[model samples]
Target: MRLLFVFGFFVTYGAVLTATVNNPWPNFSGVIILWFMIYLITAPARRRREYWENRRALQEEYWRSSIRYQNRYRY
Candidate 1:
C-alpha cells in the first residue's frame, strides 16, 4: 500500500515537472523553496519544542537510573 502511494506520487510529480520545466535548474530550485516555506508555515513552534525537551529529559533520567540500579547489583 505504501509503495503504491509512493509510485503514484512520483509519477504525478514527474509529469508536472516535464510539463513545467523549461529551465530545469531554476524550476527545481523554486519547487524546493516553495516546499520549505510550506513546511515552515505548517510546523508548530513553542509547545512542540517544550514537549520534546520534556520527553528527552525523562528518557535520559530513565537511562541513568537503570545504569545505577545495575551497578548496585554488581557490587
Candidate 2:
C-alpha cells in the first residue's frame, strides 16, 4: 500500500542520514539541517500542487456545466 511505501522511504532515508551523521564532512549539524530543509520544502510543494490541481478541476467543471446550460436554452 501507499503507507507501506512511505514508511519504507522514510526508513531508508533515516538509515542513510544516520550514516551521513556518523561521518559528516567537518560536522554533523549541517547534514541534519539539510534533511530538515528537504522535508520543509517537499511538504509544502506537494500541498501547493494538490491545491492547484483541485482548483483547476473545479474551474473546468464549472465551464462545462455553464456551456451545457446555455446550449439547453438556445432558440
Candidate 3:
C-alpha cells in the first residue's frame, strides 16, 4: 500500500514535470518547494524529531548487540 502510494506519487510528479517541463523550471521548482512546505506544515516537528532520535538510538543499540544485523541495516 505504501509502495503504491509512493509509486503513484512519483508517476504523477514525473508525468506533470516532463509534460510541462518546457513550460518552465521555476514553476516546477516552486511546486517542489510547496510540496515540502506542506509536508513540514502538517508533520509534527517535535514528535518527528523525537521519533528519529529514538530510531537512531535503537539502531545503535541493535548494532551494539549484533555486528551482522548492524552491517545489514547501515545507511
Q: How many clashes in each structure?
A: 0, 0, 0
lDDT of 2 at 42: 77
> All models: lDDT?
0.63, 0.68, 0.67
Model 3, residue pairs in steric clash: none
TM-score-best of 1 and 3: 1
**Candidate that scores best on lDDT:** 2
* TM-scores of all predicted structures: 0.36, 0.42, 0.32
lDDT (10s digit) by residue, model 2, range 1-75: 984676556655665665654574343354566556666767987799999999999998898779676697677
Q: Which ranges in model 2 have alpha carbons more than 4 Å from their true place?
A: 1-13, 17-38, 68-75
Candidate structures ordered by TM-score, highest first: 2, 1, 3
Clashing pairs in 1: none
The CA lDDT at 29 in model 1 is 55
> How many times do residue backbones clash in model 3?
0
- lDDT against true structure, model 3: 0.67
